[model samples]
Target: MAFDSGTVSFRRYAVMGRSPREPSEKMLQTLEGMSFAPGGSGASQEVEYGWSGGRHVLDTSFSFEHNVFGEALHFALRVDTNRVPAQIRRAYQIIEDEAASLGNAAGKKGVKHAVQRRIEADLRSGRYRRSRLMPVLWDLPRAMVYAAVSPAAQEYLLNLFERTFELRLEPLSAGRLALRRMEAAGNRRSYEDAHPTRFAGGPDGEERAPEYPWVPRGDYPRDWLGNEFLVWLWHHTETEGGVVATGRGELGVVIDELLEMHCAFGETGRDVFRASGPTRMPEAVDALFSGKVPRRIGLIVESGGSQWQLTLSAESFACAGVRLPPAEQAVSPRAVFEQRIDALRDLCETIDALYEAFLKVRFAGAWDAHVAAVRRWIARAARRQGA
Candidate 1:
C-alpha cells in the first residue's frame, strides 16, 4: 500500500487551511516534533499515533531528501494500541471472582473492580501492544493528500495531520469533484437541478422513482452522479467502444477484472462479477436491469505508450490496487519514485478528464435525449439476455 513501492491503494483528501507548500526547515522540524513516540500516550491511554519517516515503524528521523520529493511530501502514520485478549481477560476475571467468593465474599462490585484493575495493569505493561503504519503522500501543487489506510485509520491520520501541519483534510469524493467542475464551468444551476435517471423503466411503461438510497434526495443530488458515471462508462464501452477524448489525448478504457453492483433500493443486495470482461457478461446486464448500480469496478486505461490498471470505488472515488506501467530497471531509486509519481499523476488526470466529459453531457440541454438513448440500450441489453 506504500506509494513509494509496490501496488498502491489510497483515498484522496483535499488539504485545507494554511500550510507550507514546499519542503523547508520549518516543515522538517514540525514533522520531527510530531514523530511517533512509543508509550507517548502514557499508561492510562490505550492508543497512540503520530507521523513516521515511512521507511519503518521506528523511522522518525525526517529529512528533506528522504521525506520530500519534488513538490510532494511523503510520510507514514504509526498507531499503537494496547489490548488484552478477550479469553485471557475473561479467565483472569473468573479467577478473581472465584477468589473473592472463596474468601471474604467481596460481591459483584468488588469482582468488577478487580477485573478492571487487571486489564489496566496489562495495558500499562504493554503486554498486548499492536502497531501499524499507514503511508501518506501530500501533493503540494494539487493541494491533495493520498493515504493508504482504512476508514478507521484515516480518522487518526486526519487528526494527526491537522495537528502536525495546521491544516484540515476534506474527503475528495466523486461528488465533491463533480461539484467543483460544475462550479468552474459556470453550470452550477444545472448541477443543482440534477436528479437520478431511471436507466431501466418499469414493465408497464410507467415512470418510477429511481431508488437511490445512497444518494441524497434534494435539488442537487450530486452524489448520484458517481453511479451514473459508472453506468455511462459501461454503456459507452459497450456501444461507443470506450474511446474517450481526454485533455491529454485519446485514452482507451476497458472495464475488466471485476464489477460490483448493488441494489439502489437497498433490497436485492449486491452482485459481483469477475472475468476478463465482466462488463460484457450476461449477469452484468441482468444486474443493471434489476435496479442495480455499480459500486466498484476494475478498469484498464491506455494512453500514449503506457497503460494503467486500477479498481475505482464509486462513492468515495478511492483507487485501489493500482498497477502502473513498468519503469526502467536501470534507473536510480529516486528516479523510479519520480517516474511512478508522474504515472500516477497521469492516471488521475485521465480519470478527471473522463469525468469532465461526462459532466458536459450531463449538464447539457439535450441530456434527456442522452438518457433516452441509455434507457433504450439498457432495455435492448436486458431483452438480449432474456431478463
Candidate 2:
C-alpha cells in the first residue's frame, strides 16, 4: 500500500555511497529515463521492473511536486510479469502433436518444433501480463530507504536503486543497528562480545545453548539481540505494567492482537496466537518455556498524546501494518505528507530508545542477576499454568 493513504509497512535500508541530499532536476530526469517500458523481445523474459511515480502504477511522469517532499523522495518500483498457463500450453501442444501425427507421419518432429516456436512467440507478445507496484521512500537526510516490498522482490529494488543512483543499499537489520548504536556510544567492544542470554533454564536446571533461528545464519553476531529484546519486552511488560521511560518521555507498551513464537533450536516448530492480549494466554507462556522465542509481535506504544501500533519482525527489524496517530483534517496535501513523515520518525525513534534501554541492562555487569530474575519469573509462570 502507498504510504500516503494507508497503514505503512516497510523494510529499511541504509543507502551507501555519495548521494545528494537535495532532490535535483537531474535526478528527476534519470527517473524518467529509466521509467518502465512494456513488451519483451524474448519469450523467456518472465519479469521486468523499473521506476514509476509513487502515485500509481501507470504514472511514470515525474516532477518535483509529484515525487519530491522536502528531503524525502517518494517513488515506486513497477514490476511486470508474463506467463502462459501450463495447462493451456500443454493442451495446445497435445492438439498440435495429434494434428501433426495425423497429417505427416515422417515429418512429425519438424511440425512439433514449429508448434513450440508458435507457442513461444505468443508468450512473447504479452498475451498474459500482470503488473504490481511497491512504494519506496528515500529519506535523503537520513540516507535511508523505506521500501514496501516482499523479501523476494527486495533484490530488484536494490539493483534498480544502485543502477539508477550509483549507490548501494545495505539492509538495516537488528544486529547492524545495535552495532551502530554501540559504536556511537564508545561501547563497540561490549557489543562485539555479546551473545544470546539464556533466560529460562533447561529441564534439569542447566543452562541451554542459545538457538536463534530467527537470526539469519552468518549475519552479524549480535542479531540475536532482537529476539532477546522481544523476550525482554514481554517480561518487562508483564512484570512492570508495560511502562517504559525514554528520552522522549514515558511510554506505555501493550502486547496484543498477535504473538508469533518459533523454536530457537528448530525442533518444536512454531506457534502463532491471535487475539486481544495474546501474550497473557497460557499457551504463550508454554511456548516460552518450551524454548520458543518471539519471532514477531504486535505492540501498541502510547506517548505524548499519540499512539502507534505495529507488528515488528525481530530479525530484520521491519515494521508491518503500522497505524499511526491521526493527523489534523483540512490540511494541504504537502502538510498531510509532512505530518505523516514526522509521525513515522517519532515511531522509529521511540522504538530505538526502547532498544537502547534493553541494551543498557544487557551489556551491564548485572546481566547475570537479570537472567536469574527472568528464570524465576519463568518458573513462576509455569507453576501458575500447571495450577
Candidate 3:
C-alpha cells in the first residue's frame, strides 16, 4: 500500500504562442525527446542521470482524455546545501580529516581525493531520492496549460517547454487576463481604465495606523485585483445565497467551511485569520472589520448538479486543492482519465464565467455600490457577534 496520500496542488497558466493545430506526431516525438529521451535539455538529462529515462519512460506516449492532452515528466535536481543534514556533512568531513592524517603527504592527498570522489559519486547516483514528477495539461482549444504542481516546478517546466517547442512562454499576468476577460465580455473599457489601482503607501513603518488596521499593504500591488475579486466573491455568495445568473447560465458558488483572510495591502500585523465551519462566524466578521480581506479562499462550486472544491489564491488567481466530480465507471484507465479531466475542465469554466460576471460589475461603475453593501453586511455581522 502507498503511504503518501496528500492532495495534489494545481496551478493554471494560459499558454501563449502554441500552434493552434493539435499535437502532430512530430511534435509528440519532440516532447518525448526533450522530456524522457537522451540528448535533451538539463531537465531531461537530469531525469536520465537518476533513472535512465530513455530506457524507462521515453516509450510512453502523451495521453489524451476529453479535451486535455499532455504528459507527465519526472526529473531530479541538486538538493539545497542548507537542507543537507548536519550529521551527513560531519561524517564526510570526518572521513576527509582522517584521510589527511596519513604519514606521507602524497599518500594522504591521494587517499583524500579518493574519499572525495566516492562522496561525489554517491551524490550523483542518489538523485532518485529527490526526483519529482510534474503532470502537465494542455487544453487544445483554449491554448492553456495546467500543471499539477507548484510554481517552483512550473518554472522548470516552462523552460523545458520553450526548449522543446522553440517558442517563448508568455505567462498570463493578472493585467493580461483581465484584458482578455473584458474583451470577451464586450465591456469596451480601456485596459488602463479597468486596471486595478495599486497602493502607493510607502514602507509600512511610515504610515500612521489607519481606522482599518487589518488591511495590510499587499505583497504585490498588481495582485490587488485578484484579492478584491475573492473578497467580492465572499460578499456575493453570502448576500446572494451562493447562486448567481451569468450570461450563459446560473453559477452556484460558496465559500466552504474553510476561509482565509489576510491584510490585502499592509505590512504590519499581516496576520492570516482562518475560519472553518460556517463562514458567517463572528470571528471571520471581526477579521474583516479589522481591515482584512481574502488573500485566498476555499470554494465550493456547483454547475449542472456537479460540485467541485478548490482553493484560489488572490495574487495570481492560482487554484489549488481542486476536487473534481468523481469519474463514472470505466473499463480502462484511459477512459477514467478522460472522464476526470472533463469534469475538471467543466469546473474551471464555471469559475471563469463567474469571474467574468465580477469584471462586468466591477468595471461598469457599479463597484462603489457593491462595496457599500459589503460594508453594511460586515457591520450587521459584526453587530450580531458583539465584536
lDDT of 1 by residue, 227-256 (tens): 889998888888878798767788799999
Error of 3 at 245 (Å): 2.1
TM-scores across all candidates? 0.94, 0.92, 0.75
lDDT of 3 at 21: 48
Using TM-score, rank the candidates from best to worst: 1, 2, 3
Error of 3 at 218 (Å): 13
Ranked by lDDT, the better of candidates 2 and 3 is: 2
Instruction: Tell me the lDDT of candidate 3.
Output: 0.57
For candidate 2, which ten residues in a row score worst on lDDT?
199-208
Candidate 2 achieves a global lDDT of: 0.84
- Show model 1 residue runs off by greater than 4 Å: 202-208, 215-221
lDDT of each: 0.84, 0.84, 0.57
Off by over 4 Å in 3: 1-8, 18-20, 37-87, 94-119, 173-175, 183-190, 193-221, 268-278, 329-331
Extract clashing residue pairs from model 2.
none
Candidate 1: worst-modelled 10 consecutive residues by lDDT: 201-210
Tens-place lDDT digits, model 2, residues 153-204 = 8999999999998999988878888898889989999887787777665333
Q: How does model 1 fare in lDDT? A: 0.84
